[model samples]
Target: MDPMKVEVKKIDELFRLDGYLKPFEREIRRRHGVLREWISKIDQLEGGMDTFSQGYKHYGLHFQQDNSVIAREWAPGAQQVYLTGDFSK
Candidate 1:
């Protein structure tokens, strides 16, 4: 699979199913472009979509072999965060 080769699927089937959607086709394509840009950015910054999407496995509570609990959160906007539970106390 060549990285430069872009396989574009036509949306003609959608317009065939409903003529009303034809007017909004341009907007749909623009939105797809935005999505592609975001995907590219994530691939460059986060080492590809597979690792970026699997953040749940890293950014949450986990138990270690020593019976210790680790709590982690990614909150960029919050001024403060608190972890409360039987293990946290």
Candidate 2:
């Protein structure tokens, strides 16, 4: 499939933001680019938004067999994380 192209002039005209946003045009364009990239990625993801966002269900805390508890989290960028709690009564 051919990648979609974003035309800045068409967007500027459609939104009528050029006059009011001229001073910040560059920043606006950069943010628009980031949004476009995100859109493209979401569109390419299989099973759409529901499957992509189901990450929360797989992360976090849960209860397991034999009356035990489990905790989990996704923090790829973090150097370390410590889980602290008084699970004992």
Candidate 3:
């Protein structure tokens, strides 16, 4: 009756349907369990998958309109960082 209980039954039927996967059934179930748990945590923390994936936009190198590039990093423990490259025009 519980929605969360569906994954177990589905996994069982899935393995039964695929004879070739029988050899890896145990490992497959274990990985599926871990994947489900991680999805649940991400859903709770980010509200949804779309928002969670958008987190990548916050960090990395970005280009500006002034023909310059900026690099960003989230290093809380580091006091300073240096950038060395040719970003001139």
Identify the candidate with maximal TM-score: 1
Expressed as tens digits, the lDDT of each residue in 16-73 for candidate 1 is 8999988977776666676788999999999999999999999998999998878889
TM-scores of all predicted structures: 0.71, 0.56, 0.61
* Candidate scoring better on lDDT of 2 and 3: 3
Candidate 3 lDDT tens digits, 31-77:
76777888999999878798878766877887789967677787878
lDDT of 1: 0.78
lDDT of 1 at 16: 88
- C-alpha lDDT of residue 71 in model 1: 82
- The reply for model 2, stretches above 4 Å from the true place, is 1-10, 14-18, 39-49, 64-67, 77-79
Cα lDDT listed for each candidate:
0.78, 0.68, 0.73
Ranking of all predicted structures according to TM-score, beginning with the best and ending with the worst = 1, 3, 2
Question: 1 or 2, which is superior by TM-score?
Answer: 1
Worst 10 residues of 3 by lDDT: 1-10
Please provide, for model 2 over 21-70, each residue's C-alpha lDDT reduced to its tens digit, 9 standing for 90 to 100: 66666666677777777777876864666777887777788878877877
Give me the candidate number with maximum lDDT. 1
